[model samples]
Target: MWSWVLHRITGVAIFFFLLVHILDTALVRVSPEAYNAVIGTYQTPIMGLGEVALVGAIVFHAFNGLRIILIDFWSKGTKYQKVMFYVVIALWVITMLGFTPRHLINVFSH
Candidate 1:
């Protein structure tokens, strides 16, 4: 249902983020000055917020992925799939709440 959709979406988002990360890291070997210029844009407040979204996506994707594994490997897992979905959501919310404020403070304070 919704979890399936979200898992796919988050997985795609994470994949793209990793692709960009690899590309950016590779840029340093190609041209240090160009790489530095590219990374400088990430210092902006907008990129700071993007980092928050990236973290959120990674957290949700990781938790939901474990839930999927449980459903696949644990015999009783299917019986509790709905509950596990809720648990994943609860964990995601708690994690984001703990992370967002501290990160925002650091991002804005800079």
Candidate 2:
């Protein structure tokens, strides 16, 4: 139940992130200075934290997608759905734990 809700939420968040990413990248072709100005804002500590959230969302979404695929394809998938959900969560936590500190250091050191 919660997994379904979170998967949908993360998917929407990722979609919006991609939309913004595309628009920002396109800015370079339209005007280099404007693109640079936009990118400069991303260097802030706040944006750095946003990047952490983005990575967390992506990791969770990806792992949860794989869990969904297993649920659909494996014969015993339904039987172990709850366990698989936990595995997805564990993987997401480990990944974020590894990423957040290094990212914060780089963000703050700059």
Candidate 3:
């Protein structure tokens, strides 16, 4: 139940993020200085936290989607849904562990 709610929330977040990212990146073609300024704002500590959250949302959404796929395709996946959810969570944690250190280093390097 929590997974379902989280999956939906992350999906919406990623969707909106994609829209904003595209628009922001498009500013590069319009004006270099504008783009640089926007990019500079992303370097802030809060934005760094947002970046971590964005990564989390992406990873969780992806793994959960794969879990859904497995539940649809595998013959016994329904019976093992709990296990699959745990696998998704474990993978998500591992992915975050791998990403967080480097991201934090870069974030605080300023």
Candidate number of the best lDDT = 2
lDDT of each: 0.95, 0.97, 0.96
lDDT value, candidate 3, whole model: 0.96
lDDT per residue as tens, model 2, 1-110? 99999999999999999999999999999999999999999999999999999999999999999999999999999999999999999999999999999999999999
Task: List model 1 lDDT by residue over 1-110, tens digit each.
Answer: 99999989999999999999999999999999999999999988999999999999999999999999999999999999999999999999999999999999998998
What's the ranking of the predictions by TM-score, best on top?
A: 2, 1, 3
lDDT of 3 by residue, 1-110 (tens): 98899999999999999999999999999999999999889989999999999999999999999999989999998999999999999999999999999999999998
RMSD of 2: 0.6
Candidate 1 Cα outliers beyond 4 Å, as residue runs = none
Q: Identify the superior model by lDDT, candidate 2 or candidate 3.
A: 2
- Model 2 Cα shift for residue 108 (angstroms): 0.9
- In model 2, pairs of residues that clash are none
Local lDDT at 18 for model 2: 100
Ranking by lDDT: 2, 3, 1
**Best TM-score goes to which candidate?**
2
Prediction-by-prediction clash tally: 0, 0, 0
Residue 51 lDDT, candidate 1, scale 0-100: 94
Error of 2 at 100 (Å): 0.4
